[model samples]
Target: MFKIGYRTVKTAVGAAAALFLAQALDLQFYSSAGILVILCVQNTKRKSLKVSLHRLGACLLSIVFSFVVFETIGYHALAIGLLILLFIPTAVMLRMEEGIVTSSVIVMHIYSLKTVTWPIVWNEVCILIIGIGIALLVNLYMPSVERELKRYQQLVEEYFKLLLHEMAVYLRSRESDWDGKEMIEAHELLHQAKALAFQKLENQFTREDDYYYRYFTMRIRQFEILERVMPLVASLSWTYEQSEMVAKFIESVGAAVRPESTGLISLQYLHELREQFRVMPLPTTREEFETRAMLLQLLSEMEQYLIIKSEFKGKHTYIQSV
Candidate 1:
């Protein structure tokens, strides 16, 4: 069985309503209203508003120009062609090119009526109102996506926890057979969540910054830091004694990562880890030296990771406090 989308159903109902309203009002060339409805319904409310304005402007331009040309040259195919030649350039100049096709319908109505009188103009005006109005009404109530965004937020946090915990496990046991596929999966999830957040931003209709969009963007940045940390983790050998402290800290970071939890405690823990790394005995062998260097780099990257989340949380705190 085939199923129709809600937007499709709304479009059909809106078109029917415009046609019925036009006929009931005894408007001339009533079919134009239905055509206008078909032309005006857009995927987003923002696009619908912009397209409706352009079409309305173009229709008005067409009606006025058709009046001047048909009154002077008489209604004929030649007159319609001449009017279009002039009208296209004018519409382009006015940046109402989107309305060109819809306006042509209005011009044809005038030509068929064979007059440029006020009554004819009024008929086209009514058509524009019914069509654009019904479309605006149809698109007014967008479904809320706050719940979906919350779901995405939780999934992202879960993946962060798992990824960090996996890194901790790897640091502690350098020869784990973990495939690291979760990093790729987490990246894909972030990409999809960001897209959904942007769509939600568009649906908001208000000029306010979206918390979900900002949150997803922060996660994207943190994910980049995590990617950098993985290579450092993979390069080092299993030094259970040396990696013990840092591995525990990484596990703590994974546990602390939450939407409400600021990275303050984790960052403080990171500073202590840095001090501990500094006070350790110097490496005696080349391999030991390289491992120490890799471990230090890992610490730097982890500090940056916690800092990214910390700064994001700080900004939100500042805003809420203000």
Candidate 2:
């Protein structure tokens, strides 16, 4: 089965409309308007506006330069050749280089007519208006992705919970046969969530940043810490009392993981866990000492994890985890 993309469909419709309106108004070189539509349509509304403005500037430059040169030098091969040579640098200087290709069509249209007149210039201006105007209109009707973003947020939290649970299980039972697929899945989910958040951010024309954008960024940073924990868990060879204690703390963190979770409570609980680790009997054997050291490292990683969430929520004044 073949599927057409939404932007593809919009571009097709916009181009067809530009062509139809240009012909209906009896504009000369009406096909150029359609070509402009195809060239100006962009992936995002902001991009479309930018390309349209650049093309408009380039088209105007081409007309002015072509009129002056072709009129004085006579409409001949040399004049057309000379126009190309001079106009390209002029367009680049004006930062309308992206529109150079599209505007060249208008130059050819002027040369083919063998005379630069008011009506000819007006015709090209009309074409530019019709094409760019239609493209802008098409861009105005962006579909909402709020629901999809919410769904992604929910999925990310679910994967995070699963990841914490896996970590807890590994810490509790040193020899468990758990493959680290959940970590990979959580990483993949965060990647997708970040992409979606970026798209959502681009869809809006706002000066202020969206909360979801910040939320996803914080999650992405925490996800890196999560990835680091996996190797540390895999390297452990001994099961100690400290390991289970840390495992229970990780389970508490897993229980509290959510998009709305500030994790401050877990941070406090981590402090308590550290105190418990402190006043307990010291390790006698080298193996026990190594286990305690590993547990301490894991605790540091977990503190970093909670701190990231705290900072994000702190900035926005929103408490997500308790």
Off by over 4 Å in 2: 68-82, 89-95, 207-209, 314-322
Off by over 4 Å in 1: 64-97, 111-115, 238-240, 313-322
Computed on alpha carbons, the lDDT of every model, listed in order, comes to: 0.86, 0.86
- Quote each prediction's TM-score: 0.85, 0.89
**lDDT by residue for model 1 (21-41), tens:** 999999888887888878888
lDDT of model 2, residue 76? 92
Residue 102, candidate 1: how far off, in angstroms?
2.2
Give the TM-score (vs. native) of candidate 2. Answer: 0.89
Strongest candidate by TM-score: 2
Q: Alpha-carbon error at 258 in model 1, in Å? A: 1.1
Please list all clashing residue pairs in model 2, or write none if there are none.
Answer: 260-320, 260-321, 261-320, 261-321, 262-320, 262-321
